[model samples]
Target: MGRSGPAACGQTVAYGLAVGVALAATVQAAKADPLQDPYGTWTLQAENDAVSTLKGTSDQYYTSGLRFGWTSGTNNQPPAISNLNSFIWGPGTQRIAIGLQQLIFTPRQTQVSQPAPGDRPYAGVLLATVNLISDTDVTRSVAGIQAGVLGSYAGGYQVQNGFHSLISDTPNRGWSHQLPNQPILEIDAGRTWRLPLITRYGISADVLPEVSGEAGDFRTYAQIGGTVRIGQGLDSDFGTPRITPGLDGTDAYKATRPFVWYAFAGADGQAVAYDATLQGSTFRSGEPHVSKIWDVGEFEGGAAVLWHGFRLSYTQTWQTNEFQNSKALFNFGSVALSAKF
Candidate 1:
């Protein structure tokens, strides 16, 4: 088997989980007070398009990421437009957080060998994000902005190849399929509405509607969707709960809990107006003899658990075929672990 195969994909995810577990253990042993509101958080996330046990030797892509976040009350406020701050963070009670993230992506054997041209290649990304959150009796919402850069020098290929070498008992070497350098920018806003029916069963349920846009060297697209979550508290767009500096005075709506968990499901559709990888552009030339499918849909379901400020979530996603000639229906698994301190 080549570098990009089901076996290689599985190895990548296992390696990521091993690293995450070690990090989690280190954090759990720290002396931070669990009862106090968290001033910061750290997260580890992984995504893989193929699992040998789930589906045999199919669509394969691997991604692993790590992020660190800091809240405003525990640190100085980030500079922003005065009016923009006032609009998103209402006067009542609010939270602001900044995050730094790193992500790596690699193509598989199936992807590289496919007849379709312009398939995504090995790449890595570094990003910074700012989020504004408001939680009150009458309203609950979040808005965010992100900026990032992607390139071969980001070391995605090196990481993946290193893990593969260790697992396959081979020496580290180079692989084909990679993307050109690029910059990314995005902004989004969303609101959640409590569902009265679910509250009767000791379940906190809500519907979230959101809209977002992105402009970047790789792709440009806009998305609108709604998600219904039946759980203990509101779920963030990225599948976690928003942690604030202060808790609501009421016992029914405390900000932090000793243990919490929820099940969630959602769907979204995207209008792909531009894709540098698919449609040749100035930033990067498009692949030859490739099929371009402009519209894509994604259906996702997942569950999350939180205990003593530690959170773990698992989500499975099914996405419609992205290319006209593609016979494979893309599916992937997402795992995220986070801790508050």
Candidate 2:
């Protein structure tokens, strides 16, 4: 029906999956390690709204994101951080991660330099985060803290327009009305449990359910959701690592088979308390703002492949509107490369 509709979703995911499968040809299978050991993996991820190959969708609202993260080997974490995490989340095998990310958002109409009334506000955010996670075969607990800045310091304008010029795409002209600079601090934690459904042949299936909360200037919300995944090596890791405000897993994983693969679908709903991008500057007087919707939902589908110790993943996401009178379905794609040592 629409560019962000199911037809587009299929084409987008089909295009998204090509690279991961291609990498499978380059890797040779080996013996998998233990099922529960995930240590020393690094992940690099990038997300954008330009994944069409079918019907191109407009690049607006959560248009771009980049993240890099590393998880520590089990028991090789910072003592103070790991101890505090174990104390709060309860004892289990523990690892800590460090991450850096930048995200950019814009209004539906980018044709004018001035702000579009009744549209999502323009905003940019950059954050550095620390995460500690504990795991057993069937359950996982995680806690995280992030600090960063919003607005120009995050370089939304320069990065977006620079890339646009490079690709000869239409320039986004609304950065003049972007949110004012503000410091941001956020903290979040959650727990997820795995329910084994069945294992047939070398393929298996499982459901991962979770509950989580976040609070601070960046965003405040409580969420509940679950993921259903099927493929080979279901016991290799928790789920998939993602930048949140939604469901996500971690990069930490070990080789449970010489070659591993899986496809997944997940959905989540959020009861939002506040969202800085939609509500505008926290402490400043003059900034763009919009009427925000308190409830939002997202649907996602994707796949991952790991050969030897290297992993590759692709995910496509569709989100409900976040602001008043918005037409966007928030279609986006995430591609990630990760490796375990």
- Each candidate structure's TM-score, on Cα atoms with residue i matched to residue i, is 0.68, 0.87
Q: Candidates' lDDT values, in order? A: 0.52, 0.83
Model 1, 1-341: lDDT tens digits are 46888989999999999999976754443223212232455555555554222563233433455456655432224445334656765442455667776666444343333322444344566678777765444344556777777666556666656766677744223234455667766665555433323575666776655455455554566666555667664432224432110010110122344567777777777777665434433354553324557787777777777676667776666667555554354666666666665
Report the number of clashing residue pairs per model.
1, 0
How well does model 2 score by local distance difference test?
Answer: 0.83
Residue 219 of model 1, lDDT score: 52
Identify the runs in model 2 with alpha carbons over 4 angstroms from their true place.
Answer: 1-39, 52-54
Tell me the deviation in Å of residue 274 in model 2.
0.3
lDDT (Cα, tens digit) per residue for candidate 2, span 90-136: 66778888999999998878888886788888899999999888876
Count clashing residue pairs in model 2. Answer: 0
